[model samples]
Target: MRKYWFKVEGLMFKERPFCYLKFRHFIMIVVLGCFLLTNGELSSVIEIEARIPQKNDLFSNGKMDSYDSLENRKLLLFIIDFNDFMCLSCLDSFLDFYYCLPSDFQKHLSWGILVFNISEKEGNNNISARIVEKKLRGFVAANNIKFPILIDKFHVFNGLAEEGTVVMVFDWNRKMVKRYVFPLNKGQIEEIFKFLTE
Candidate 1:
């Protein structure tokens, strides 16, 4: 067997045998492959091909639009049940994250809040769709939200996630990449920022 040597500055270091180096590299590759597989599985909570409704009634601005209209931009849809208090709080945090993004990043991103009110049976009364739309409009106005306010009158997005509030990120090709529930933590936010900047 022959030995290999490496010099760095004034120091000389003995290198491992070729066979040993090959075995080590093989082990490292296996470990890295496993890590990537596991990370990919854990990162994507749900995969969806969400199609935005084209009806003007579905939009708070009363404009008919389709998902095709958002071409060439990554989309971030905040699906929230407006009746839930926790969801409302999460929306505020989401808005904070959105506001902190640089203007250039914001320009490349197409984001909107898909607001829906799930009617719960309270005695003999149930919230009407008209009332829900009115309330959602007020909420958007009070917050001064400039992004599209998608009104889900028929609970179209309610089944997208188990949580009352969810943040779904879609690539430019309209494939859902990530789904986050509740308020986004620092690490999650950082990951999203990385995606947006990419």
Candidate 2:
């Protein structure tokens, strides 16, 4: 009878390390799921899939090469909202990818960036069209950016001068194929380049 009681207590009350770990992970996943659903804006920014254009025979055309105009060339438009480039984690991702871009591919892509600023209760002109471009050049040079990061003082998302930036990738076909919202890992950049190269 004592053995039976001891077994019951051990099984019922003892902390199992594996089980505890599993329970903690489950709780985290649930909390993350709840957070993603509750906060619509952050959730949208957290994960995004861009629209990829369908490949056609014209994809092999010479218009995709280095000789093409910057506007006609494939473009990677990265819109950045953070005013301070040094302290931002997103800046790290941008620098990593910018440096990783192969020379041959870099010339043809014609990368451009639009820097934006968030506003307080001010009436208008939250982000000076001039300041935004200047900040962009600083980041581009500091990070050894080989591509041009154009300034968009007016944050044109939907409404005029909307905040936050989105990364847009244009294919050789002169179509805006994809827009990357969140910062990406190295593998993601590789895949994007690979898609364009092919």
Instruction: State which candidate has the highest TM-score.
Output: 1
TM-score of each: 0.52, 0.49
CA error at residue 168 for candidate 2, angstroms: 1.9
Q: Candidate 1: misplaced stretches above 4 Å?
A: 1-72, 85-90, 104-108, 111-127, 173-176
Model 2, span 1-198: residue lDDT tens: 999998875675465767757777999989987986876232012111122322321234534424444334455666665553546774666666666666644543444545455565543553455455455556655665654444544454423214334567767565557766556766777767875665
lDDT of 1 by residue, 1-198 (tens): 123232441132124466566777999989988996766221211112234443322233435357666454565677766655334665677667767776633332444445554446532223455565566667666765545555565455668745756777776554547887767789989888776667
What's model 2's lDDT at 129?
56
lDDT of 1 at 14: 28
Model 2 residue 155 lDDT score: 50
Which residue pairs clash in candidate 2? 113-149
Q: Clashing residue pairs in candidate 1, if any?
A: none
Reference-based TM-score, model 2: 0.49
For candidate 1, what is the lDDT?
A: 0.57
